[model samples]
Target: MPNLNFEFTEEFALKMDQNDPLRSYRDQFYFPKVNGRDALYFCGNSLGLQPKSVKTYLEKELENWANLAVDGHFEGEDAWMYVRQKSKPALAQILGAHPHEVVAMNNLTSNLHFLLVSFYQPKGERTKILCEAGAFPSDQYALESQVKFHGLDPEETIVELAPRAGEHILRTEDILAKVKEIGSSLALVMMGGIQYYSGQLFDMKDITAAAHGVGAYCGFDLAHAAGNAPLKLHNWGVDFATWCSYKYLNSGPGNISGIFVHERFADDQSLPRFAGWWGHDEGQRFLMEKGFIPMHGADGWQLANSNILALAAHQASLDLFAQAGMEQLRAKSEKLTGYLEFLIDEISGNSGILEIITPRTASERGCQLSLLIHKGGKAVFDSWYAHGVVGDWRNPNVIRLAPTPMYNSFLDVYRFGKILEQSLHDFA
Candidate 1:
């Protein structure tokens, strides 16, 4: 984590930007406009800005489809049949797993369901799954339905862990304690890699160990953590994980998601899964075999052939990630997000109008800092929007600002601070 000795002046922000190693990346994305000016985008947690190269990537695939038609699946430089392989190298780097352990596939929830089919095994006296309270709605629905599918009552089969009273983030010790308390009956330990609402990054390594010690499978919903935070699924011994590509990933909205299954389970043929032709061994795939012979590693979980155009757009951003590197991006992200938190503290001061609910430490969060509105509510958010600030507003009260290191700069954070100052005063 960078030193919090941050300055609130524009000159300070400018100097920091001038010294940033990833500063050139800001020009690579197209920002949305507010009124006549480019908006200060701090919504990467919700949806990332589009990379300018997305069009070029899409065009190449379209041309291949036009000229090759049926042959496009086999003859093109990036054949649709093998397109999933193109993303593995970069996704592996971002996810800290071996290339074979990760695969780009269905949307977030679908992949979760598929992984649940294999991981969420409930035997006698071991029938409960644990997760954070207020998890993203999709995860809640998936878990609820999965429990019902097994003819179990969700109220009894699922455990939701909330923060302590008056707390907005779950503490590491508290989470571990809960895992231990749920020990004997815990079928699986599943939670978001980062809490979406509180911007809290959980200690996956320790949590995974605790789950394993208690004889349970561990998994994560990485939709908010994949590109924004550093992860080591392989080393942590995470049994399974999945994430969407549209947020910090900078892929198009609702694009394909990625899956990670530990190599230990790679060739375990006896493990149960919903099989499809795409996941069959290549040698026998064309035979139209009556039996399902699964491929090794995460590839065995794929349910269908790759989506060429979507993978094309996904590749464009993954290429940039490969060039920029996760370590370098994470370094800048720490400082950039730290500066935003510093400025928010300075502006909010002792005025009880707003409070930052996100964790204060860099290790406990990614790039997002969710602000809890105590006074102006949506009116204050509207004021920021009117002043050319693009942030995410949650249903009742919170405003989320994610200063993505790939494209956002110190100047953007500084500008948003000024806007926030004005908006608070006007609403107050």
Candidate 2:
């Protein structure tokens, strides 16, 4: 790779921004203004800024509700029952999944629980669950609860894989080894697609194959991975996956989440699920029959009526995603994020004030870079916020900066580097 330090200059950064094919995408979002200027936001890994068109989408629903009342479900311009269907192709394009394999439904954790109810079949000797050691809290909680619900002891039935001592990232070889050793007794193998803290993109293809070879079901929590990286859930043979849209998806906070069930399990009517009216077959839905008949694909997994307003907001974001193809977005992301890494490495040299815990390789990580502040810790990070550079601090000493390809630019990375330099100098 070319030297990142020499490649970024004021003139060069400005020129790159000018020639950027995706530069117009910035206009779609609404960023917070600070001190009469738009703040430099690098927290897309946590909460993405809302799209400008979202308000219009919400207003349309409000108007329908006012004019039609209960009749709006069937008579509105965008019928509520069919609203999710509109977003399927767009979301499917982003995830590299077929439209029939994906569904828009409940929030991330709820979907995870629903999926586990059907996929995590722990019987006899194959009753242990395997996951990364420091998974997102919600995932950890879901696993523990699932084990408890099955009347099993979590301490005995849950196995967590940790990185080697003195290392922050887990090696693929180590993970495979552990899976092989515990193969026969493992009931489920699930992990975050990209680790939230370290930003390491786990090898899903390898892991899924191993899990299947051992007769275990494999799933993924794509909370931080979905739109931030390229994914082919179907081709990878993952049993199931779920993701929130607020992060790299650029949907607003608490926006609708999505779930994917490979075609292999689509018609497995034998699988047990916590069913609801929404999951019932749409053709016979009005029949109010005693027995439930699920839709042939992912739509069959829905449990209740969806929140159409949130789905509308999600559509606005997905429209933008579709316009900017994921492959193109990912290409720009590699260069933009690589530029960020270059800037930080230059400024932090010999100061020993910070260290990047996220992996260095472009292929091994996503957009977020976790900075381990070595000097003033949280105090130093808070000062950066006071200076109008917005990023997230995750306990102890880490500040995460996610330079999203859709909105963030090379200049933003350069400005953040200057701010970080000043903060470190002041602390010394």
lDDT per residue as tens, model 1, 58-148: 9999999899999988897888888899999999999999999999998999999999999998999999999999999999999999999
Quality of model 1 by C-alpha lDDT: 0.93
Best by TM-score: 1
lDDT of 2 by residue, 203-244 (tens): 999999999989899999999999998898889999999999
Misplaced by over 4 Å in model 1 are 1-4
Residue 136 of model 2 has an lDDT of: 96
Please give each candidate's TM-score. Answer: 0.99, 0.98
Clashes of each: 0, 0
**Over all chains combined, what TM-score does candidate 2 have?**
0.98
Instruction: State the displacement of the C-alpha of residue 117, model 1, in Å, after optimal TM-score superposition.
Output: 0.4
Residue 146 displacement (Å), model 1: 0.5
Error of 1 at 135 (Å): 0.7
